[model samples]
Target: MNASLKLLPLAIGAALAVLPAAYAAQDNVQTLSNFKTTGNTKPAETVPQTGTRADALRENLKAIKLPPGFKIELYAVVPEARAMTIEPSTGVVFVGTRKDRVWQVTDRTKRRVADDVVQFASSVTFKVPNAVCFSPDGVLYIVEQNRVLAFPAAQFFGEGGPDVAAAVVVPQGKLIPTQFESFNHGARYCRVGPDKKLYIALGQPWNVPPKDKLAELDKNGLAGIIRMDQNGKNREVYAHGVRNSVGLDFNPKDKSLWFTDNQVDGMGDDIPPGELNHATKAGANYGFPWYGGGHVRTEEYKDQTPPAGVVFPMVEYAAHAADLGMSFYTGKMFPEKYQGGIFDAEHGSWNRTKPIGARIMFTPVKDDGSVGETEVFAEGWLTPNGEYMGRPVDVQQLQDGSLLVSDDYAGAIYRISYAK
Candidate 1:
């Protein structure tokens, strides 16, 4: 048997022998690793187009299979909203768009409505704004292909319209530049860590590269989490070898950071699975091209072995799920069973022979922040014949204990709630 394959039976036996023990360990550590990135190329810029396709599709959202007395609703009309963030004080929601604009949606009268949609920020030439987030103090941070900009929360949404030109420039180092021909992941997602520092997700430039050329790998070198102070200073690598992580969230109770990574495509349908990881410490390397899921080896990283102290994912989802944004439920609106569960939006898949992952998934989370088995939360977005209605991109928990889901393909945001 091959040396790598030898590790599998052992790992599997270990997993099965002490499954409960493994769960105990997971509850304690709350981390995992090793994955790749996958996404469609950024769309080209075009004039703003209006539509009711998203509105029409909202009626089709299916109910999650849950206990009785729980209900979910279509919350708001946010066209083309993805990578969402909510301002705690005002309950105002902000989302980035593929049209190079950021939109703010407000909740009123138990309904979410677009109070005022403005071109909050713009990319000179890029097709989309990568991500957006609000700091604890209410500062709005927006990430473009090659730049990071911030505006005061109160000032941006105050009586006067936001002065986009007056926003503070955040130094993004060599990661983003004005002109770049190649080697840019450009899927920058950010969140505030337990330590109050900003953690940004930077993707690998290539899925799998030639083994001899390690430097090319470094271009995506900051493939994992990049930590920086609020001012974007003291930047350092929090972890390494992550391909691309679009969905990231910090557990409010344990203060641990969690993320969802889309694995590399073109691999056979079931060779490797999508991963859910936790950022445990600074400088930890999760196996990437080198190692995956404890024993799965890739051609590009054959000789390399998983380094000591490297972590693996807490749980694995179906291959080609295209898992994206993740958020932990910490609200009182839902049953206590869902208080700490994770809601992840699977953007669906393009590289698979069979369509998968067009809906949101739920994973039971322990008090210590480790995840349990994953179950389907919502479905029916994909037709039985494999045609897709919408692709979910992100999920966020609202101040009022509701959930917001962003669907980039249909350009709509749907709200999931529970009620007696």
Candidate 2:
């Protein structure tokens, strides 16, 4: 063996010895590495995952305000439910979470309600697998902090506990540069775009990335939505200057990209508004730290010149609403006015002095692709007294033309439909 080859085992041993200590020195206190599948999660032990608190759920659902003929009901109980995707062929709803597990919810009886809510790949290890999406051909892609995994023929996989095998498309360490990895804003949301590319949101670790690290961050696809071939090659940033966007969907009519951005905070109660943004062309720039939410500039970069052609938001919501997962309405069950509309989830506020969001909002999209007025579609998760009964995280349309909304706080998903 060559001299260098002879040193391989020693080097390997040294690296093995340094592994745990290196992990210990990592700075992100809430990093995904902290949550192991073994002992850390402490998943809730209860059926209907929301438990038997029927009265509270009923009251919360009752408090919801919707148009006539629209109603809301519990769909399933999924812990820390964040982003959602449905397998059209099998009618399986795959729910992601901010926890250690991904859930597979099935309506085995075709009752339009999920009677079986079970953990997906319960046998596999996962850390903050909060984003799940499906390809038109039934391939499932799961995005976690710093990793992307693919499960072929995912919708047909047997529904057994802790099951399913995943082929790593983007390994954990490869997605984010080591220097940019942090606990904050690491949960990724993904979808197979019209171009048949896998697109994912790679949130920056900070509310605003430091000036010194911006170049490295951008080069690594941090702080933006990135797209690549279905097999994860040729990763490229599609949008930039995005502080953090949890919700995004492609317009079916025109195949444009639209996303909701959670804006900068510490700007007082209502200075910067949360955003509903549209991306018309490739490599679009949505102003972030320079232009905090929509047009409001961040105090840190108040005087700096922003990018010349930064794209602004289509609509702005009240500041700190925590706008999250969204999907364009393609269902026919709702009124004709809602076809091709947008249904978005507001995950509610965490830092504001006055809490807001915690509801589902809708925006109408006209044939000309102009976004009409925005309105509250369903609420009651947060009460008049400011108590949070639930926090809506994502919105996905079911095969039946209804909608499924996920809530992390209440550990449940709700189905919304129209009767008239």
Candidate 3:
């Protein structure tokens, strides 16, 4: 009868807790009372936010708070935009989503306002193609639910659209082992690291899986980040024990890995917090089932001993923030104080009693290259009445030193620029 239980994907929590494990694994997917995710169902009368009205959207932008001399503008109207990457040559921004399409926002006149917003590859059948990045050579890479793809001519030659027949890099069912596909936590966020290797995140499907599944999880490279050669050869696990990291970027200063993890939910309203994790090198494991968010132990794995030498998070944020896409600011547009900092998107909480974190946050890199605590950069999406006008899903910086923040809820991408 708990209010939060109604928001779960399956039956109420109390009812599921008493069910046998055999029945729980009938579909080979386990759902726990404490492991339920924020479901996708909305109220019957929930109006669709398609981001079609430009003038009305600009009026709402007046309320967002940013540091002085900085301004926000309506860049492009992209529905379901999750993570994005920019093509340096043409100034086209490629955006990915959990839906079946990838969007391209172009500024042909160099006016900063996007005049063209269209689907990149209308011919290809995309399934949750939600993360995108560009190589130094201008090749566009898309990481999806079940595979990885590359478009060598994505910028110049493929301007008309991708040729799906020749653009397959990592084929279908090869991203994961194929046995672990589920509707939950398969958001693939990826990029080409400074070392020129392609890094991809494969999230574990269960909320808090049983202890017996850890070895298989490791074997399948779920709950971890993996990297490989540009041709998808010699793929290896880079970091492990990460629970659903939808955002990741290399520190421009160090070229090492840093990411945002959506921690285990349903532990109460405010026990465990969202995490900004860092790994000095490959083969490091950030704590997951043993220590859910920070060091807060989940009720399921409180008794079992976690593997030793587990790495902890560097920066922590408010619980249920759903921190998704992030990038480090290496541009010259923002003030000197804002340089070399990290910008992240908190997609907001769904099941919490009081919803929080429909905002964009910033964290500065210290003098010694350490990460600092999070500070709100752009907010006002979640209104005073706990309703969402927009939910920021990702953040990207362009060649002109401005920033792009995508909101899947409002279905628009806003441009942030600095004048002074």
- TM-score, each model? 0.80, 0.88, 0.86
Residues forming the 10-long window of minimal summed lDDT in candidate 3: 38-47
User: Higher-lDDT candidate among 1 and 3?
Assistant: 3
Better of 2 and 3 by TM-score: 2
Poorly placed runs, candidate 2 (over 4 Å): 1-51, 54-56
Instruction: Look at candidate 3 and tell me the lDDT of residue 256.
Output: 85
lDDT of 2 by residue, 1-420 (tens): 433234334433433343344432342211222222332243323246344654466557878888899999877767777899998776889889877778888888878877767777654557778889987777778888866766655655535233343455665567788667677887889888998888898888887667888878777778788998766668899998888888899999889899888888788888799999888888878987798887888888888888889998889998999999999999999999889999999999988887998999999998887889999999888888898999999999998999999998987888999987
lDDT of candidate 2 at residue 178, scale 0 to 100: 65
C-alpha lDDT of residue 50 in model 2: 48
Candidate 1 per-residue lDDT over residues 1-420, each given as its tens digit = 333233333333333333344432332211110111112133322223234653465456662333466555555556677899888677877788655567766554545544344444222222456688877767666765545555455334332332232232342234443333134456678887768677788775567645654444444344577777655557777877787788888877767778887776777777578988887667777777675433466776777765677678887888888889998888999888778889999999888888898888989888766667798887767788988878889999888887888888777777777787
CA-RMSD of model 2: 7.6
| Highest-TM-score candidate | 2
Find the 10 residues in a row with the least total lDDT in model 2. 27-36
Q: Rate the local accuracy (lDDT) of all candidates.
A: 0.65, 0.78, 0.79
Q: Which candidate number maximizes lDDT?
A: 3
Candidate 1 stretches with Cα past 4 Å from truth are 1-55, 62-68, 108-110, 122-127, 154-159, 176-184, 212-221, 292-294
* Cα lDDT over the full model 1: 0.65
Q: What does candidate 3's lDDT look like per residue over 189-302, in tens digits?
A: 989989988899889889887778888887767998889876676889899898899999988777888999999988888868999988898898898888889989989989
Clashing pairs in 2: 121-162, 121-163, 122-162, 122-163, 123-162
